[model samples]
Target: MNVTESEIIKIHNFIDLLNSKKDSIVVVEGKRDASALKKLGYYGKLCEFHSFKGLINFADSIASYKNLIVLFDGDRKGKYLTSKIISRLEHRIRIDLSFKRKLVTITKGKIRHIEDLSTYTRLDRFTVL
Candidate 1:
């Protein structure tokens, strides 16, 4: 699959934005999701939503953060989890879902989980010098 230059640029910008975040906590589905973000150069705080017993604990764990980036899978479970998190944490935590939506669209239906993001964004492997 050929991704346009614009797509690469957007992914780069997205990674940069995540890396620059200081007051935000990224909530991913699991360790793989966190690893994918690490591969993309995000060194900020990352919490695995599935690790917590429930939304209450997850929200409490990240209560200190001013913003939360929920990078869940694009699948049904992901959507349900995202909704639950938003419903419980919306008042205190600022949530961002744009990245996940754009990522799901950009993958061309090849990927549904956040962990797969690295596979699409790894343009370096296809580049030739």
Candidate 2:
């Protein structure tokens, strides 16, 4: 997979877009996923599934938030979780999957998981051959 400099720049811009959403909480699957987002300079609220007591509790905890951005991995488990979260909280919270959609679109499927973002965070040394 060849990642051009232009694509990297676009991804950085997308990260900036995420940073702009300070009020929205971004949900990822685990600690590494959260770390990846931070490495990419994401400064908004980030929730990790592993840190919660359970799905129900997690949903209930963030119920008060107006917006949520699910950045779960693109694998089967991640997709399942995303669906479950949406079904559980769709009526209560404004779940924004657009960021996730834009991420998959911008990366062209290379970023199947949030943790994979680490590879692109370091702009100066990024090179894929």
lDDT score, candidate 2, position 49: 89
Local error of candidate 2 at 40, Å?
Answer: 0.9
RMSD of every prediction: 2.3, 2.5
How high a TM-score does candidate 2 get? 0.91
Worst 10 residues of 1 by lDDT: 120-129
Candidate 1 local Cα displacement, residue 19, angstroms: 1.5
Model 2 stretches with alpha carbons more than 4 Å out: 126-129
Pairs that collide, model 1:
none
For model 2, residues 3-104, the per-residue Cα lDDT tens digits are 667778778799889888866888999999999889877888888987897888898778767899999999999999999998888988898999999988
Q: Which ten residues in a row have the lowest lDDT in candidate 2?
A: 120-129
Per-residue lDDT of model 1, residues 9-124, tens digit only:
66667788777878988889999988988887788888998799888888889988999988888889998999998888889889988767766665566677778767645774
- What local distance difference test score does each model get? 0.80, 0.85
For TM-score, the strongest prediction is 2
- TM-score, structure 1 vs. true: 0.84
